[model samples]
Target: MNSKLLARIKVDAYCDKHLFYGLTNLNDGFDDSRIKYFSEKDFEVVLERVKSLGIGIFGIEPWKNGHYYDCKVYESHTSDPTDATWYMTCFENFKKRGDNIVYAASYFIPKKLLSE
Candidate 1:
C-alpha cells in the first residue's frame, strides 16, 4: 500500500494560540508541531517534494470555522466526533469562464482510515 499525507498550511487569520496551528498531515508520518505555522513559500517547496514521492499533499484553509472552500468533506461510520474525511479540491482558473478560484485548503480523514 502507498502512504499518503494530507497536510495543511497554517493561516494566521484562522488560528488560535491554544490550538495547534502548524503544518501537519492530518494523518501520521509528518508533524511540525514546534512551529505554529508555515510561510507560503516553504509550503510550496514541501508540496513539490512530497508529490515527487508519490504522496498526495493538500492545502487547507478553514473559513468561518466550519467551511472548507477548497476541498470536499466526508463523514465516517464511527460515532466519534473526530471521525471524518475530506479530499483536496484545489483548483486554478476554476470554471470555463475563469471566474472562481480557491487556495490554501485541504481535506482530512481521521487516522488515515480511508484508502486511495
Candidate 2:
C-alpha cells in the first residue's frame, strides 16, 4: 500500500464503519447494529482496492425502522426480504467511486473472503 494513499484513505463510506478484514460475529439482532461506518477521502482508492480483489457487493439492506440506507423512506426495498440469507444478493458493479459516499449505502465488505 502506498504511504500517500494510506494517508489519504479514510474509512470506507459504505459500511457503518471500516472493519479490519476479518470474520466478524454478526449477532441475531438488527443487521445494521452489527455494522460500523467509516470515512473516506477518495472513492477511487476504495474502488481500486475492491476491484483488484474482485469483491462482489450485494445490494443494501433496509434497517429495522423499515428505512433504507441513510434512513431514507422505505418506499421500496433492495432484493427480497423474505429469505434471511437472501439479502445482498444483487451485485452492484461500480465503474467508478466518489470521494464521499451517501444514500443507498449500507454496504458491508467482509475483511476477507475465502472459498471452500
Candidate 3:
C-alpha cells in the first residue's frame, strides 16, 4: 500500500473510542498445532509472488508480558478495555498455577513529531 492509502486507513481505524480493527484467525475448527514451520529460504521462494501485489504483509508475535490462555484479542468485541488493534498474539503456559498477571503498556508511533 502507498503512504496515502495507509495514512487514510490508520486514521479511520484509530480515530475514536467506538472504532477498532477486527482481525482474527482463530476458531478455524482445526488445530493450530497443525500450522507448519518454514525456513526463511522456503518462505522467500513461496511468497515471492505476492511481493509485487503492492500490499502490506504483517506477522504476529506475543508481547513479552501477559498471561492469557492461548490467544489475546487486543481490543475486545465490545471495546471493553481499549479501542485499537492493540497487539494480537499468543501466550505461553504459566510455570505455576498461581502466577501473577502482568501487563506492560506502550505506544508505537511510526514517526517522531517535530515542533512547528
Candidate 4:
C-alpha cells in the first residue's frame, strides 16, 4: 500500500461517508473552514500523526492493487471489479439502509500508508 494510494482511499472513504467532494466540503461536525485546510501535505502529516496515535492500517496487497474476493464477485467471473465484484450489493445496501450499511462492510487499507 503506497502512501499516495492510502491517501486517495482516505479521501474516498471520507467522501463516501460524508457525501462530500473534499475536506473543503465537509460540514457534518467539524468546522468546514478549519477542516478545509487539509492539503496533500496535510494528508502526509495526518498519516504520520495517525501512526503516532497508534492506529494500525491493514489491507491485502492484491486487494489494495484492485483485486476482489471471489465469493464477493458479481460483476465478472474474474477477480477484477470489471469482471465482477460486490459493488451492486454495496449499492443496494446503501439504498436500503443508507450510509450506516457501509460501516457494516469491512475495509482493508494499506499499512504502508501509516509508515513514516
Whole-model alpha-carbon lDDT for candidate 4: 0.32
lDDT digits (tens) for residues 43-83 of candidate 3: 23222322322221232222222223323443433342223
Candidate 2 accuracy as TM-score: 0.28
Ranking by TM-score: 2, 1, 4, 3
Which regions of candidate 1 fall more than 4 Å away from where they truly are? 1-36, 62-116
**Tens digit of lDDT per residue, candidate 1, span 1-116?**
22322222222222222122344323121333422223344334433433333333233432222233333222322332232122212322122324322223332223332322
Clashes of 4: 5
Worst 10 residues of 2 by lDDT: 86-95
Model 1: lDDT equals 0.30
State the lDDT of candidate 4 residue by residue for 1-116, as single tens digits: 99767676674564344332332322233332223323333333433433343432221111111222212323333343321124433334334533211111122334443232
lDDT of 1 at 96: 31
With a 3 Å backbone cut-off (N, CA, C), the pairs that clash in candidate 2 are 11-39, 16-36, 16-37, 17-36, 17-37, 21-111, 22-111
Which consecutive 10 residues in model 1 have the weakest lDDT in total? 84-93
Per-residue lDDT of candidate 2, residues 1-64 (tens digit):
9864543233243332332243232223434543432223233333334445444233333222
